[model samples]
Target chain A: MDFFKRQLPTLLVLVLGLGMIIQYYIPTTFSQQVLKNVNLWIQIIAAFTLCIGITSLLRTHYTKIRLQHSGWAYSIILYIVFIAMVILGFYRGIQEGTPFRWLFDYVQTPLSSTTFSLTAFFICSAAYRAFRARTMEATIMLIAAIIVMIGRIPFGDMLSAYLPSFIPGFNDMAGWIFNTPGMAARRAILLGISLGGIATSLRIILGIERSYQGKD
Target chain B: MGIIQKVLNVDRRVIYLIVFLAVAIPIIFPLNLPVTLTEEVMGVYNEIENLPEGSPILIAVDYEPSSSPELNPMTRAILKHCFKKNLRVVTTTIWPTDGSGGSIADKLVEEEARIAGKIRGKDFVNLGFKTGSYAVVIGMGEDFKKTFPKDFNGNVLDKLEILNGTHSNGNSESSLPNAAFSQDARAKKINSLKDFSYMVCIHDDSSVFTWITYGYERYGIKIGTGCTAVMAPGNYPSLQAKQITGIIGGLKGASEYEKLMNYRGEGARGMDSQSVIHVFIIILIFLGNLTYFILERKKTVRG
Candidate 1:
């Protein structure tokens, strides 16, 4: 059982991972065909992951409902909405002007938009409360933040235009800040992240990283 | 606490109310603010503008409904531009999609195509959603036909004029000389991702990186991106690195594109609300700092 569960998956990863890596260099017809087949398999596997997610959601919600846990009422709502969406999707199809499409356009979109819009309020509140200039570094950051926040808006550009043509406006200054020093820091951080990613991938490919499989 | 401190100490609910007012009032009574054009946004505009008429370009709708408000305008403007330029657009999505499918790529492209007085299969096509995010990109890089055998509307790819060349399937129409000739030079057949004139990916997430790494770097396809405002900063590295041709970032970017197109759309309309909210936030931050400094000075004198 251990061998079937652990050894086999590890072996498959080692072989397939090595094959995928080598495939990039080969550039032959056979390698192309292999890459195509592998990509299809990956897609099929990805689709099944969605199924697994649905199944997990069902199990968790079913348990909560069965136990009559706190907030179990919300679970009922989830089930109703989930089943309704599924039935509508399968019945009339997801094409234009169907009940499914109508529900999507009217119901889902507004709900999502409203939820995301709430962030603006929270952000405003947070900026008012937490954006204090205590230290020198904090002061510098606060100033930069002010420039970027103001510059991103059309009103900022309008205000900037009143200044002399020779002097750069908040727009130009913000662009420089974002593109120059900001990009430099981002590039360094991203390079470190990518290198770390490659290392983790190598560890997994070599079967040296089994943490993802969970504890025995 | 004095007036400044009292104002600073106002309930969080007041802050929320103010933000709501700031956003809602502008939408009702638009500021009609002038949106400034930037070099960053012009990059996307110039690329599509310069493409030969009937040249095929790929559009990836890789955002969800949460980002729809910001990204939808960019998508619409870009689509309008592509159709106006008579460029052949092939759209696909890898964003799993909220089962609540509002404003999806296929539907948006269909709407834009109809308005442009262009035929669907000939002028553009939506290949629809596929699984395996980046792997789907690699698959397309290898061969579009194999990755997407049929369009979103259940139309086989080989039947589409923009996809399969006019002379394909050995039709006797080739014998008529001019009958085989069309505006699209390579419209004969689009085999791989590299065949498209350019690819514009409207994304709210990290999917653009895969396309840039695989589609652009590996296959030499030119890429541009339109993303939500929150995502704009992350995409700057790609824009600076020239991995992408250019970017349309958030509603502001969309409004800039709208100005360039000489058309006022949702993007331009939404800028008023965006500008109001930004300025309001800036004022809040400033007031908060002023209160803090005043309180500190008083405490210092008392000590």
Candidate 2:
């Protein structure tokens, strides 16, 4: 029973992971067919996993509501919204001109947009405090940020028109910063992330990463 | 207790008020400042312009409503350009949250197609939101129909006349010019990722990485990206690697695209407000630094 619960999953992972890697190299019809079938299986599994996610969410909220936890009202509201959306989705369908579509467009979209727009206010306040030039590094960062901010917009181009022709304009300097130093830093980070991903993937395939298997 | 210290320690609410006014006033009174096209924005435009009329292009709308303000303009502009050039468009969304992202695409495509006098299933098709993210993208490379049997509207892929000349057979033989091409010689059938003339992803998040890795690196499909300004700098690596052909970054990029298209849209109008907020932030930064330095000098002199 223990083997069927834990070891079998890890064994399946190893076999499937190795099969996928090997399939990528072999161009035969059989290999291609295997890959196609595997992709179809993945899609099917993903659809099932979505159902599991919804059930988990419902369970969490239901427990919170039943226990009368602090802010349980919010949980109730979430349940109401969730059930209402699902019911509407099924009743009128999710197509355009449907009630579900109208709710998504008018209610969900505006709420999400409002939430996102609040970041600008927060960012402004945060920047005021954080961009202080207490050190040389801070000064350089502040200046670079200022240049990039100005250069990315139309005002920078207008300012460039009046400046002396010999000196590099804000737009030009910002472009250089983005292309050279910015590109270098981003590439280094990307390389690190890619290497880390590969290592983690390999660990999972080799059964060294058993965290995903959960405590048995 | 001095003015410099007071200025340095001003309440955050004051700062917020200033920012709010900075953005609001610009909307009421337009700046009409000239927007120069960046090489990055132009790169995307030029690539789309270079494609032959009726060539199939895939657009991945990988953003939710939160990013709609920034990404929607780019989507609208690109759709307009594609339809204007008489290209066939195939759009899908990887976003699965309430499926609003797919709906956004449908709404925009419908409006743009109506304006362009293009018919659905003929000039464009919305495959809608498909699950399995990278898996579905990779699957499309092998056999697109296998991954998406039917579009968002429940129309099967085989029956879509717009997909007629595409690689339906999953063989190299389908690459040959269709004999029936004379009827609609402009529209080419798209069978795989490589079959599309170009692929553009207008995203607010990290799905562009999946497209680049799976769609471009694996299948050799030329890809461009349109991203929110916040996510744009992160894409510089992909741009430098030539993994992506070009990028339209944020409202500014959208405005530049609009200028190229000679269509003034929300992106252009938003720039006036964006410019003001940026300048306001810069001024605040400068004032903060100036006050800090002044207080530091005063402290040294007193000592």
Docking class of 1: medium
DockQ of 2: 0.74
Give a tens-digit lDDT track for model 2, residues B121-191.
88899988878888898899989987888988779988987788532222333333432342243545677
Record all residue pairs in model 2 with backbone atoms less than 3 Å apart, i.e. clashing. Answer: B165-B189, B166-B189, B166-B190
- Model 2 C-alpha lDDT per residue in residues A103-208, reported as the tens digit of each score: 8889888899889999989888877776788889888888889999989998898888899999788889888888888889888898899899999999999999
Writing each residue's lDDT as its tens digit, candidate 1 over A1-216 gives 999889999999999999999999999999999998998888889889989989999999999999999999999999999999899888887777788878877788778888988899899999999899999999999899888877888877888979898988998888988898888888898899999999999999999998877798
Clashing residue pairs in all predictions, respectively, total 1, 3
Looking at candidate 1, what is the lDDT of residue B230?
A: 75
Clashes of 1: 1
Model 2 residue B271 distance off true place after TM-score fit, in angstroms: 0.7
Q: Candidate 1: which pairs clash?
A: B165-B188
